[model samples]
Target: MERWVGKVAIVTGASSGIGESIAEKLVKAGVLVVGLARRVENIEANAKKLATCKGKLYAMKCDMTKEEDIINVFQWTTKNVSLVHILVNNAGGNPGTTLIDGDASRWRQCFETNIIGLLTATREAIKIMRDNNIEGQIVNISSVLAHSNWYFPTINAFDDGFV
Candidate 1:
């Protein structure tokens, strides 16, 4: 619908799955898209698949858990593209693990990547938007597990913080 024409967007975990879909949709709508993920090759491959979009596409390797990476990505976008108009926090995943049976390290990893990472990215995005006085959209990609009892309490806590 061209709702994103002239806008810039950042989509995390955009190398595959839902993040990839969101990036495609944004590009189709004419948004300059910056895709961030740990897998640089995958993101670059995906960007190459979007040759039809009228907007520019940049794929960056960024681990959301790292504040420096997030900051650099935001800075790169601002320097190369228009002010970011949309931010899709689409990273995070939890393997099938019951609360009691899950490995402590695994659980910790999930919380760090899903909750802490999202917060860090959001903080940086907000800073950029506020500093530029840019009114933007933030589309947080959250799973139902955030509220459902099927997941750990940490998931709910993370979702609550975002709300």
Candidate 2:
């Protein structure tokens, strides 16, 4: 991780939960982090708390379901923090709809966020890495419900999407 010190990282869904923890850890390791999520205020608050850390944290409002939002985030990072050395695709959620009885719109929303959004972010990140000749890392985060169905059954429950 010391090698990543002073590097730039983008973490999605960083307003809370696992994403928040990952962002904090990276910042502590001296990695500049751009935290993205719809709840930008939460990230801003967290950034304030982490101000004394070795690295800096920037909060951005991004809705993973929107391609433009994802693209804008990357652009912001490039112009503001430098080319990203790492990207964490940590934003995802289920629409609370079962397979048999589900709303198409809700399911589509889930797919866009969990699948399309991740791919778009990955593609953008890779392009930056390749263009800059940087060996960057992309981390996709998912829930355990992806592997086991014992938990609640949801139409958009994370599974194999990260793959």
Give all candidates' CA lDDT scores.
0.79, 0.90
- Let me know the TM-score candidate 2 reaches against the reference structure: 0.94
- For residue 28, model 1's alpha carbon misses the true position, in angstroms, by 1.0
Please give each candidate's TM-score: 0.84, 0.94
Give model 1's clash tally: 0
Clashing pairs in 2: none
Cα lDDT tens digits, model 1, 1-163, are 4666978999999999899888888887888899999997987887788877776568999987687898899899889886888899999876335455556776666677787788888888888889989888888887765545663444433332233
Error at 71, model 1, angstroms: 1.3
Model 1 TM-score, 2 decimals = 0.84
- Model 1, residue 163: displacement in angstroms? 10
User: Clashing residue pairs in candidate 1, if any?
Assistant: none
Q: After superposition, how far is residue 20 of candidate 2 from its true place, in Å?
A: 0.5
Model 2, span 1-163: residue lDDT tens: 9989999999999999999999999999999999999999999999999999999999999999899999999998999899999999999887777767878788788888889999999999999999999998999998775566554566444333323
